[model samples]
Target: MTLYRQLIIFTVVLFLLLFTGTWYAKLANTRTFLTDQLESHVQDTATSLALSVSPHVAQKDLTTVEGMINALFDRGYYQRITYTDPRGEVLIDRTLPVKVEDVPQWFVKLVPLKTPEAEADVMAGWNQGGTILVKSHPGYAYETLWNEVISMTVWFAGCAVFMLAAVGIGLKLLLKPLAAVERQADALGRGEYELQDPLPRTREFKSVAEAMNRMTVKVKEMFGEQAARAEGLQERAYHDPLTGIGNRRYFETQVGADLGEGQGRGLLILARVHALEALNTERGLQAGDELLKRVALLLQEAVSGYGDAVLSRLTGGDFGIFLPHHSSAEAEIVATEIASELGRLARERLSLSDNIANLGVAAYEGSVTLSRLLSEADLALSAAQSKGANGWELRAVSGESALPMGQQQWKESLVKALEERRVTLDAQAVIANTKERGVRQLELFARIAQEDGTALDAALFLPIAERLKLVSAIDRMVIEEALRFDFRSIGVERIAVNISPTSLEDEAFRGWLHGYLKGLPAGAPHINFEFSEFAAVQHLEMIREFAAAVRACGHGIGLDHYGRSFSKLGYLKSLRPEYVKIDRAYTGELLSGENDSGFYVASLCSVAHSIDIAVVAEGVESEEQAAVLKELNLDAMQGYFFGRPRPLSSFTAA
Candidate 1:
């Protein structure tokens, strides 16, 4: 339970106990006072009546005595009234009907009310004639006591409610500072070394806050000092100090890790500035260093979109990058981007020297080591130098292959593809097994069709589009097509469309998407937006904003290709995505012999299930794979064995 609730309950309970005891005491005192008042009132009434009736008693006038007694009875002051002569003989009597025996006789006897009896001597002319007597009614006294008890109870109940409310509010305020302290301590443990705002002026809280603030300041100062030292050492260990890019050691470490794990399939690019020593000798060392820095900056900016792609200055004038998880087309796009940026920088530096930067790129796949990747890239670089300066060559693993067009050619093709509306949609089905038959879901895929009506595979052209910085245009086209598609006719319960991370970063693109989605037909509830786990993790804040925008339009968000990178499961709980498509690699190995893929998949399913996220297995190619996934209780499955990628026109409504 929260501290606020616990504190409030404790305060209210304690107050109730104290209030109850006090209320009981007040009730007892009121009852006693009422009883005493009744006793005194009866005694006085009897004495006054006895004196008044004495003359009649001495005259032996029964009628006068009876009249006086009847007057007292008519007043209704007593439950029972009795009058007896001096000889103790009954003369007049009045009593109420008995109903179910009033308070138990034993209980009444234990704490009996003392009914005071009054006596007077009847006389004629101040002489005694006969004795008149009166006794108080116990029932009347009991009734008065009961009335007082009811009044006391009502007052106590009202006071208890008021006191409990007041105590609850006060306790909550008193514990507010303690709650703040706990939150601050939690933040500190999570490595957020900053103190929260100042606490209230409670003495104990103030002291603790001051101490925490001091400790945070000290820790931050120490970290800053240590970071400075580490930066200096890193410069010597892994960076080219003049160029501000990684040195040879950094290159080896990165390439080694990528090739060692076979983590992602991609190309490596190596480039060298020719005649650096000659330039330094003829001009000056300062000019040469400036040239290297310019080249390093150009390379860095070119591959900025490829998250985790590493660039380093291997040695004098040479730079390299391991493009993990990128295809041959992606590598070519990176090479062109770098080459263009370098060309611009070279032109600006031409006023100082007549040197032009040259570039080289290579693409490889299928279990390559670091040495082989580097060697291939270097071979391509050497080939580019041999052909001519200010040019680049792209080598493939099969042999050295040359790029036919320049950056302008690639850029024009991407622009034309968007303008011509050549993008087409492909979809894969997600099936859910229910008691009666099953449910079919579709995932949207983007394909580029050429002018000749031949559909170009996404694998061939997406890299080029991205390299030309036209991914946002392609993404927008995909969204437009998805919105326009009639999925209801095809019986697709849900249509998931992939949104690029690059497009999400563009505020203009986000605005355009929101406006477009707002105008979509009201009956279309099947459209769902998706973003890759790798992209979402890299630009978390941007993706989150996009997801919120999508959800506002009455659609849901999904994570595609989840588990591409190691991510905290906590994000799943916070983002609360509707579904996640497990990465194909994990699914492919799930049924491999002598492997524990079943356990791994089951664990992932369990975690996702815990947060109410539906998990779908991707790239399931066999019945065995599907059975294993079903055994794990996977929510859905998609692969070639079940159904190959096809156009939306291929399927009909069920």
Candidate 2:
């Protein structure tokens, strides 16, 4: 039982004991007082009657003596009154049975009131005439005692009830601080730091609350320190000091990993500032640095609308940009935009040469070495430098042709595909690292089959769809397909589909998603919608609301590419997604020995698991990587090492 109930019960028992003791004492006192009153009443009446009857007895008035005795008996105060002659013969006699009225029989038996009899002589002048006897009635005594007992009991009962209620309320108020302490402890367990407010007055409780507050603050500081250390390590290793973007090392590691996997089509642009050494000789190094910073800012602004575009400082004057899943036709537009911005920078006197920069754009597809792409872009750069001031060029490597479709063609193709319902479902299993090697769940990717029988992954088409405001349509179609899947046949209880944060912004899409989830069959597999961490951070409110609505229908949400953005880890506490798939860029850094990536991954796992969130490492293509991840306390692993993406219909019971 709770302390409140225990205290109330203890109070009740104590009150009952006190009532029992006081009530018994009162009963004993009442019985003693009544017995004395009865004795005195009988003695006084007998003496007075003897005196009154003496005169009558002296005259031998038998009728008068009998009348006097009868008068006293009829009064009912006396139980009996009798008169006798001097020779011991009875002259007049009257008696009534000893009985009590208006009192319970149990009460009378429990407390027997004494009825005392007393006698006095009736004398004629100097001799005794006769002896008169009188006995008092106990009925009046019992009535008085019963009334006092009833009144005392009612008063005690009322007092007990009022005391209990007052005590209960007081206890609840005093214990309010304890409730706050409990909540604070729970929040701490979930990696949330909450302090108890309005310190308690009680000394012991106040001490406890202070200690808890101190501990909470200490733990929060520790978490912040760990997060900062990990982020600092990541920054020093991968980010450029000058521009606050990725350095050449980060670009090679990330872009190489993406192209090595042969995932899809993309473009790489290499821009070199012209005559930077000459400019630095004319001005100071500070001015050259200022000029470079402006160029970086202009490049970032020009491609700000594009998704997953990586810009980096390759060397002193050469910069690199990699756009994943971007078409060749858009490549020229991006190149010319950067070139036009550089020309404006020259006009603003940031550059001494009118030929401020030359951009060499190279398109790539499928698996290829990083060196080959760089070589191709370098040749194109040489061609641009020969052309004139602020010139640019676009080229593709010898055998492979770039994706020929432009923005308008992509819009037309995506719209038609959605209209024709030409989407196909592909799934890859996330396998647990436990001894059972069980499949955790399937991650679904939407693919559009082209007229030539070539399938286009969402990575290749989603950016275009989002740009054309057709992402919600694609998301809706993918969800409908996922729901129609036969999870029972594969013995899988859950599946996850990617969801664009943009889709959640559409009121109609949100309504349809909620309705569809609510109408699912009773035994349908639970659906988990995934949002990239970068996009999720941008639209947290929308995702939070959508998460709440879907969770009401037995669904949940997860974060994909988790560590790709520079968003704070604190949001994870509020978002509380079902799981987070660590970005492949981090996963690609895992090696057999100790490294910064291992420390970073371990830190991520610690932060996530403290809040009961599962951490998954995606893109685990080698046993060494998986073994390294397994030691990092990752909940699951996903990538080609387990299996490649295949048709959902091909899945069967494991």
- TM-scores, all models, native as reference: 0.58, 0.80
Question: Per-residue lDDT of 307-410 in model 1, one digit per residue for the tens?
Answer: 65667888888888777656676666777777677667666763244336566676764566677777887788878776654677887663222223345675
User: How much RMSD separates candidate 1 from the native structure?
Assistant: 9.8
Judge candidate 2 at residue 406 and give its lDDT.
Answer: 66
- Alpha carbon deviation, residue 146, candidate 1 (Å): 4.7
Please give the range of 10 consecutive residues that has the lowest summed lDDT in model 1.
Answer: 398-407
For model 1, the stretches where C-alpha displacement exceeds 4 angstroms are 1-7, 79-87, 96-116, 119-131, 138-176, 182-196, 211-242, 248-269, 275-291, 301-310, 321-358, 361-380, 383-461, 464-499, 503-541, 547-654
Clashes of each: 1, 0
Best by TM-score: 2
